[model samples]
Target: MLVEINLLPKKEPRNLSLLFAIVTFSGMILIGAAFLIWQMNEKKEELANVENQVQLTNEILEAKRTKLADFQSASSVQELEKAIKWAEKQPYNLVYVLQKLTKILPERGFLTEFNLEKDSIINLIIQFDTKSEAAYYLNSLLNYKWIDEAVITKEKAGDWEIINNKTPLSDDQLTDLAKKNFFPRYYAEYEIRLNIAELKQAYKSEMEKSKEGNKGEEEGGDSP
Candidate 1:
């Protein structure tokens, strides 16, 4: 009996599924690489813009600082204060003016008005017991060192006088010159304007000197 054994050939499964999986994974890697590259470019652009803005801001701030400094230097109050400070340093003596006035006043004369002005002018109104006394006062003021360009503005006769015995003004005839007060007895009233231009000029000059002094101090402080 020759029985032929029937044998079946071993069947091989298809590898299509593994090939599909590999293709999908490779495509996903490529897409991921593209996205990463795009993100890197966007970040670089943003950084550049930020840097530019910072540079512009710095330039604007520096310009404003320069303008403010210029304005402060040109202010009117600054100029006036500078002038006043300089006046304080000057060697002007108001006491000398008072002394000069005292030296020139006549015994029979009294000051009815005294005005000092910023423009370097002194206005004085004198009331005298006699016209001659007023004349003497004018002559004495003219001879004073601090008085210049004296001019009488008005003159009139008055009859008011005060006699003080304590001043030792004992002139005869009026006999009791020190004890007698008289007004309108040949009286003369006059207004005199004197120039004090020198005082004003001196004040201005001193102010300039002070500015120079302050500048020197600031410069010294800045050194080292």
Candidate 2:
């Protein structure tokens, strides 16, 4: 009569505190590691972008430098062309001037040095046996149609030793020169200015005449 037999065993209370704590700590660690991985990926992307920008900037700078170099080369060529044109326009003819000088030179005097200067100026060193020859040469230059003014800037006695050394001579020639070096000689340095305006006018007239002559020749040849 007393009590019914219990078939099931009595249930024990389970302690879940330590397991829950371990699960919470492991979940936090996994979340933190995932967040750190995401941050690392973002940093790598930003670094790549910065490197690409730097490369692009360098490429742009190189292109600009190439363009600048090309521009400078073009400018230099243009300047050289302008200088050549200016030179062509200048009314200066060395051959014509030399021919005139040869025609007007004194018979007894010889030119030792001749220099052509800017603004159509001629500097000449002439040696003569007498001072009158130098004076005559200067007067002739002054009276020339092409020469505007002529002046004897310097006059001095010629040195035989200096003049002899100017020419290459053999030993026998040098001995003869030494024997004949007793006579005193004179030299004059002259500066002559050319009439540039008058020369330009003359040159223009000659060019016109030449053109007319050429045209007449062509017309004559074409006539039946």
The candidate that achieves the highest lDDT relative to the unseen native structure: 2
**RMSD to true structure for each model, in Å:** 21.4, 14.1
> What lDDT would each prediction earn against the true structure?
0.64, 0.77
Report residue 125 deviation for candidate 1 (angstroms).
1.5
Screening candidate 1 with a backbone cut-off below 3 angstroms (N, C-alpha, C), the clashing residue pairs are: 86-207, 158-184, 159-183, 159-184, 160-183, 172-175
Candidate 1 on 1-224: residue-level lDDT in tens? 89998698878987989989999999999999999999999999899998999999989999998998888777867888987786565455554565566666666556666666543566777665555676677777677444566666667643322332333443343434432755333333334444456655755676789999999999999999
**Model 2 spans > 4 angstroms off:** 1-90, 159-184, 203-224
Off by over 4 Å in 1: 1-91, 160-179, 182-224
lDDT score for candidate 2 against the true structure: 0.77
Each model's total of backbone clashes: 6, 0
- Which digits, one per residue and each the tens of the lDDT, describe model 2 over residues 35-89? 9999999999999999999999999999999999999999999999997786677
Q: Ten consecutive residues with minimal summed lDDT in candidate 2?
A: 170-179
Q: Best candidate, TM-score-wise?
A: 2
Error of 1 at 118 (Å): 3.8
